[model samples]
Target: MDCASRKFYHKHEFDCRDFLEKYCADKPDMEFAEDALQFPTMSFHYVFSSGFVKGDVLIDISMGPLIHHLYSACDIFKDIIILKLNEGCNMETSRWANTRTGAFEWRHTSAYVSKLEGKSAQIQDKEMKLKEAISHIICCDFENENITHPVVLPLADCITSIWILDAISKDEDEYMKNLEKVSKLLRPGGHLILIAALNTTFFMTGGERIYILKHDANFVINALSKVGFVIEYYAVQMRRNDSTLIDYEGVMFFTFRKTK
Candidate 1:
C-alpha cells in the first residue's frame, strides 16, 4: 500500500500547523537537536551548506529545528547572526524556542534531542572544532513593521536561512520588500543560502487547514536576482527522502551572493 496515495493508510488526523503546534506542547524539552534532519530534505542542501565556520555570519528567521541541528553539526562562523520574526521571542507561549540559549524545542523530535544529547557544549565543541563564535543580531526585531534602509545586522559576513521567505509573506511585494530589508545588513560579496519547499497547498493537521503558498523555484530565483543577489550555486532535491510523506510538496535549496 502506498502511503502517498489516499486509501493506503490512516486518515490524517492533524494538519501541518496543528502538528507544528502540538509538537511544541507535548514535548517541550526535546525540540532542538532533532531538527538537524531538515537539511537533508533535499538532495543538495546537505552537500553544499557549509554550516557555521569561523568568521562567518548567519540569520535564521522563524527559528526551526534546522537551525538547532546546525548549531550541533558545524561551527558556522566567527560571528553567528540570528534573525527571527515576532514568533521567535515568545518562548512560553510558542513551544520550543528558548531565548536563553537560542535553541528551539517546538517540535517534539527537536525537544527530545535537546535533552538526550546531554552534556552539550556540542555547540561550543563544534564551534571550537570549526573555530567560531556566536553574535546576536543587534535590533532584535527583524519583524518590525517599520522598514528602513541598511537593516542593521551586527558582525554579519553573510546570511543563511531555511524556508523562511515564503513562510512569512503571501503578498509578493511585501515578500520582496522584506528581503530587501534583510539585505541591508549584508556587505557586498556576501552570500545568502536557503533550503526551501516548492509548490504546496493548505495542509490539514491538529484541526485546521493552514494556508501555505506554493513557490515556483524560478519565481524565487528571479526575485533574488532582482534584489542584487547573483546566483552562485543552486541544488534541487537535497538528498533526503520524503518516502513517508503523503503527497507533500518538494524542496529546493540555493546559495546566492550579494553583488551590490
Candidate 2:
C-alpha cells in the first residue's frame, strides 16, 4: 500500500460476509461476521491475557478477516512480525500494523499457503486502518532450503493459529504437520490462541469459499497434545439465532501453553 492516501496492491480478496452467508449458513456454519464485529473484545482478551505486546512476533498463515481484529489491534502492539503467505493481501491492514506506535511491520508470502485458497476472506473488512505507523519488511514467498520437517524456532513470545489448521488438512498427519511447523515459532510456556470453524464440511461468504474435514473440539485437543502444546483453555459454540435460519460455526477458541 502507498503511504499518501493509500493504494493497496492486492485488490482481489475474498469477502468475509459472502462466505458466511453462502455454504456455511447451512447447519453447523460460523458467524464470522458477528465475530468479526467483535474484533475489539476478542483482541482485548487475547492481547491482554494471552501476553501479546510490542515485542511479540505473530506469524499468521492467512490474512483475511481472521485478522480483522488486528486492524484495530495494531494500536496496542508493535514489533509485529507477520507471515502473510500471499501477495494480494490487504495492504491496508499491513499499514495499520505498521503505523501504530512501536509496531514494526514484516510479511512473508507463500504460494503453497495460497494454494490453501480462500486466503482473501482472512482480511475481508475494509475499515481496518493505521491509527499511528509502517511495516518493517514485506517478503514475497521464498523457498525453504533446509529442514524437510517443520522447523521449531524460538522466534516469538507467543504464537497464534486461527482458522488455518482445519483447512490445512483433513488428513490427521498433514494437519499435525502444520501445527508442528507453527509451534517452532514460540518458546516453551508461550501461549497459542486459536479460533476455528467447527463441524464444517464447506462454507462460503463474501464471494470467497472454504472447505473443512468436519472435526470437533476433541480432535483439536488431541492434535495439540501430540504437537507438545498443553491445552490451557478451550470453548466451543454451536447455536442458531431464532430469527435467522442459519446456524453459525460451532466455533472453537483454544488457548494452549507450550510445555517442554
lDDT of 1: 0.47
Error of 1 at 168 (Å): 1.5
**Model 1 poorest ten-residue lDDT run:** 1-10
Superposed on all Cα atoms, the candidates' RMSDs to the truth, in angstroms, are 8.9, 12.3
Off by over 4 Å in 1: 1-38, 41-54, 63-66, 72-76, 87-124, 127-132, 137-151, 203-206, 238-248
C-alpha RMSD of candidate 1: 8.9
TM-score for all predictions? 0.60, 0.60
Which digits, one per residue and each the tens of the lDDT, describe model 1 over residues 155-230?
Answer: 3466666655655555577668768866776777777766666674443444444444456779788989898987
- Candidate 2 residues lying further than 4 Å off, grouped into runs, are 1-32, 43-47, 50-55, 63-65, 71-77, 90-92, 95-154, 205-208, 241-249
CA lDDT of 22 in candidate 2? 38
Looking at model 2, report the run of 10 residues with the lowest lDDT sum: 104-113
What TM-score would you give candidate 2 relative to the actual structure?
0.60
